[model samples]
Target: MNFDEQINKLIYDWEKHAMPVLRGVAGVNSLAAVALLIYRYGFFLTEEETADLFASFDLIFLIFGMVYLTRLLFQLDRWAFIKSTWLEGVLNLFIIIHGAVNYFFGVKLLLSLSLMFSDANPVLQYQHVLSCYLLLMVMTEVTKLSTHLSNLNIKPATTFIFSFLLLIGIGTSLLMLPASTVGPHSMKTLDALFTAVSASCVTGLAVVDTGQFFTFKGQLVILFLAQVGGIGIVSFATFFATFLSKGVGLKHQSIIQDFLSSEDLSSATQLLRRVIFLTLLIELVGTVGLFFSWSEELVFDSFGQKLFYSLFHSISAFCNAGFSLFPDGLNTSILSDDTTEFAISGMRIDIRRMYGLHMVVAALIIFGSMGFTTIEEVLSPSKIYDRVKKPWKDWRIGTKMALVSTALLLLLGTLAVFILEVDQLRHDKTIVEALITAFFQSVTTRTAGFNTMDFGSMKDSTIIIMMFLMFIGAAPGSTGGGIKCTTFYVLLLSAIGDIRGQKNIIIGRRAISPTVVRKAYSILMFATTYNVFAIFLLSITESGNTDIGILQIAFEQVSAFGTAGISMGITSDLSSWGKVIIIISMYIGRVGTLTLALALSSTVKTNSFRYPEEHVMIG
Candidate 1:
């Protein structure tokens, strides 16, 4: 054999024998990284203990560097391997440079750079950067491991369900760490689980004051859970796998296709990319808008603090997670109190009347709840280009239905809130302020869960209205939950058709399929049944509390099931059993009840046969 051929063969054989062992070592290193992170940040350590942990990190980095070099040496297509793993390559290069500089020159590069930005706590800042690096490494390994999930003989629906469960488990464990809370004691197991589930489900129901109870590290964990949960764990995994692995297997694509609701298998990857891109783009825009929209009276410790607040709220808004750093939600004095004033155009104005932040968040909630499919149909560049080329072409029936229904719902909600709450408005609040608040609440009630007005003090009639809005929820395949707007639209159409004595329900000159109609009603039936059972359980569990009325219980149950985070100020007062019931409701709501049923049901279908028809009594 030629020398090149011999060398290639030698490398191949060596890799075949050595790669598995190296991978096993790498796996251990990843776990060690996780443990180190938890140790370094999740607990108080002595000076010596901290030094030893840093030493361990250096060792881990050295091992990672050696593994990457070995793989590069053995790889025949070295350039291709580096290109595919450019992110890892960059990280390794940074580690090698930092290690060499620290060892030989006695210079802490990361610490120096951090000091340039802020002189305060440079050591802590350096440690945080290292923690972030470790986190990225863990995420990389997780994406690599996720590619193997398709090999398991399980339905996509089952896998999807399990993915959320796994995410919640991890989040719970992370939140239970000592550093996750503000006090000396760690979070209770039940409370941690509830928060984890709430964040993972993007439900926004909190048993504790998020801003007051959780430390920065804890909030970061919650933020991570919310982002992953909002987009879906499966989609995130698949996107990273495809981006980092160069390509995904057909089976993986099929699974992604199922999760993303893509009609074309070949387009699944493209759709995944578009969904992530759109999400980030919208979030970025929202962040910028919020950065400028905050009232001047709201003081932050630093620019970084302000920026973080903006980013956190932006993500929360778009995810419809409804998490806020403020104690009173969007209605807090720092956000919208009437007494807080800001100078605008050389005149002092009530910060509550500014309304810019509320408008931005409301817009984000509307877009987020509209679902990716409808967004793509309306806003995708290719679609826009095509529309420009052919102005006569109309939107798809599904898009039309979603848009029309959403508009009608928003208008109805706004008018109802305005009329019902007119007498309840404070005398000092102006007409414009009341209208703005009404508009904001109307937008948030459907699924966003943000509150500018106090629901606890509102009329019971208004609470009933909000519950109906929550029940309808957002559009299908969106981040928000409930029966879904499309399902509600279908039900409405079916009812109208029946009243008119029509044979088939039609919209936009096309008849919706019987299967589609059946599925819509099935979703409604399942949602209603589940809500009734959950409310009944809550009633039993909360019987001891005389202050908790049926209206509050029913409202809370509906809010949880709809993934709407709004409450009548009784969330913290719930008994342990009541919390557990709400947790299950949030899970069921986030992953549709029909999806959970499919995951649990037998896959085998019974044979189809004809049966004799019989007349039945009408309702």
Candidate 2:
């Protein structure tokens, strides 16, 4: 053959055969690599003596998976190979393979790997734990890459995944340090991860007394986690660097869009920026208030304690974490004691101390659970100025609904708590203290579990009040949990609409979207199902403890599930099994039941081409 003909045939074969080989194998190779990761790392190192090995291996594997993912992508895209679907398929396949391996090998691995390394070196432990976190960041990248390859935006998912992984890593790092360092001998990575998750997810369940467990350094770590958690993972990440690092990629913008739930290009980044600004603004104001209130007792004390206290409580309150330096969650000493009538209440802090703490904490919790949209709508300088200029100017639908719903929830909560606890208040000094305790309890019930009054001896009616508030929770896109106040409002509005035979749910002259209604309903069902599942687990595991009742289990489970974290002093008494259940519940609650559902949800999309809608029987 002629030289020209030979060259032409060679080029055509390279394009058709070689390029296609890479594209198809992207799916296959990525899957295999991830599968190998599970069998080799996550499950195989379960013995206690192999703790360091397991830790080191898990750390290496996590980072390795991330690195390997990029390497695989590099091999595929050495050419301009841009098919993201095949990549996603491969990633999904790998995750599935890992899941299968975990179920098959997890128990054996835990028994084997954990036992081998229980007394491992602290430095090595730190190194191993840190590596796991870095690896998590890589995994997050993979998720982002896979989602980008899909048609949907995965920014929110990416921010969430990365932040969650980072939380575990930071918590582990904190717990591994000596008391001279970060202030703990050694905390379980999973437990620390749980605490970190609780702080980052802003759910307040603690296996250890956060006040007594960690040193100031450890407390600081929790504070940092709570800040990141309260702000939404993306907001914190974006604070340092937004999409502008390399001149703003479309994938980054899409991720931000998802995280903020903002479709407007102008406001996409604005939502994150606004959240950061609002968080700092609230924390700053809160710190000042707390410092002023706190400084009185240690009146001549140095600035350092006041500063640290200010920083800690501000984040705790704003995140709605309810983790306090004080042993008994909230001070009931001279503060506000809900159970001054109970002998156990004296072991709680003095009442006078709690009053200032209560008011500051209450204020912070109010802002934290109030929701960002509410902050922007109700407290935005521009909106306020505009309102001053024109009182009748319409506020955003989100703002209007948020205000009405929040007001109704708070008022109901306050009034109900007061009425139920008034008898207990009579033993206390004045109406002021009783009123403050009732009001503070009422406000925190919506999400934050901070109690001016003791939570343990409260009437069953108050617990019921708390349960209802927790179920309703904070507002949409807020720091707190539950189905979310906005969701509750929507469900109520939707019911009203249905009763009236209306086409759509309407509130404040604005019609709510069907998709939103469906999501709200989905969240409610998912939350209820999860709480039930956790309670079921607790019932089997904790039935032996006479002190712990099913009601307490239900309360603890819902508190964790709602990210509410109000315990009936039952958490510490729970079996490790029960603790594990609560940890899982807190993780799910904070990352969000929706996010977890989405994380575990089938990647398999339903057929885009739907069949005709069929009529169904109605109640």
Candidate 3:
């Protein structure tokens, strides 16, 4: 054969044979690579240890990357990889060059400038950059796997549950590692499990002090879990998969539709794209606002630490995960001087001193709880201009209901909390401080766990009010749990219609669908029944302990069920059974109100014939 013919034959053979083998090997090794990198990050390795670790990783990447690139070089002449367009090939070329440059040259340029101002040494900084790149590669491969999974005939609800459960189980094992805790001995398996569940579920109930007990590496693991849990692992993986593939398959779109609670199958792909971009955008904006809002007096010694705090809290708030790095949450004014001394950053500084930070967090929580679909409707650039031009005509019923309900709840909660706490707060804090705390409490109770006041010190009336708010939670499709505001609104309207003796329930001249009303009732029934059963079990297990009260147990159960994370100061004192109960409740809350019901309930055949009419019991 001539040279051109031989070259063409070689390209075809490589594309048919060599590419898969190389990709398969790299894909398998990518897991181990990621695991090793995570271990290195999760531990407090010394400088020598850190250097040796990355050096090994650097070697592995160098070998595999070189082989991959050499194979690519051979195939580029025939455009074996980039089938669609020349630009794709150019992009591929750029990515390969970038990776080679970073890996081979040992350039510490990326993110090194930020590390220069922080406590991170050059060795650690370089390790971080390497770890990040490795993580990106692993995630890219994993996204491919996830997209493939959608081809199977698994229910989306089942997939959602399995994803969280798997993450929780893995996270539990990771947290139980020796390096995860600060002390020599690892945490109790139960405590580690509890923390893992909390983080994985994005429900902020912790059995241990997050800041004091966990090392920086451990904290990072928790943060990783929260981010994974917050946006959902499935959603995260699929977002990248969609980006890489440039579009989603029909099955993948259906799965994404289920995850996002989007009804329009046609827009499922668009919704997935919107969900990811909007989440990142909002979180970025929130982080910047928080960075500026933080008090100078409470500033961290390192710029990186400050940035991490902003990033962590921003994710936590936006995800509606109440996990705070502060031992006392945002209510630092109540912390004793001795307890406050251990804080390395001003994150735990007095709440009154960081009023701006509180507002920023509150805003983030509100946006998070508003649900992605509602936010898309209100914030989408194309709609925003039209909305301003014709506010009433442009907005959908779902968007309007979510916004109106959210506003009403916030207003009612704020007023109730302020009125109930005014006398007590008036004596203990300034009027403005008390008002801010009340406002913050009002927002936080509904699916956010952050607090400006001690939950344990609140009046019984306030506690009851908070329980109601937590039970209602945020809007449907939001990064929160509970019955959802729409459910609560439906129930309220149903009652109002009954009282007025109207046959049809109407809102803004739109008659409600019986299916929607039935669904809303189903959610309420499931949530109420679940909460009651959980509280009952918790009371039984926790009654033996003298330090905690039944009300506190009930409060904790409600908080977990709501994924609100606020505790009446008894999360750590709970027995093993109590912790398990909270863990299950958190899991249920995060999975959602109707989802849990649907997952457990078997579908039944619909009877074509109508049953005999029967009268129900009187209310």
Candidate 1: residue 551 lDDT (0-100): 98
Question: Which parts of model 3 are misplaced by more than 4 Å?
Answer: 1-24, 44-52, 62-123, 334-348, 389-392, 612-618
Can you tell me which runs of candidate 2 are displaced by over 4 Å? 1-159, 180-184, 243-247, 263-265, 298-301, 332-353, 390-392, 602-618
Model 2 agreement with the true structure over 316-375: per-residue lDDT tens digits: 888788877655666434322342222333233453445776788888898888777677
Number of the candidate with higher TM-score, 1 or 2: 1
Clashes of each: 0, 33, 1
TM-scores of all models? 0.91, 0.71, 0.87
- Name the lDDT value of residue 280 in candidate 2: 85
Please, what is the whole-model Cα lDDT of each candidate in the order they appear? 0.85, 0.67, 0.79
Pick out the ten consecutive residues of candidate 3 with the lowest summed lDDT.
83-92
Which residue pairs clash within candidate 1?
Answer: none
In angstroms, give how far residue 317 of model 2 lies from its true place: 0.5
Least accurate stretch of 10 residues (summed lDDT) in model 2? 335-344
Question: Judged by TM-score, which candidate is best?
Answer: 1
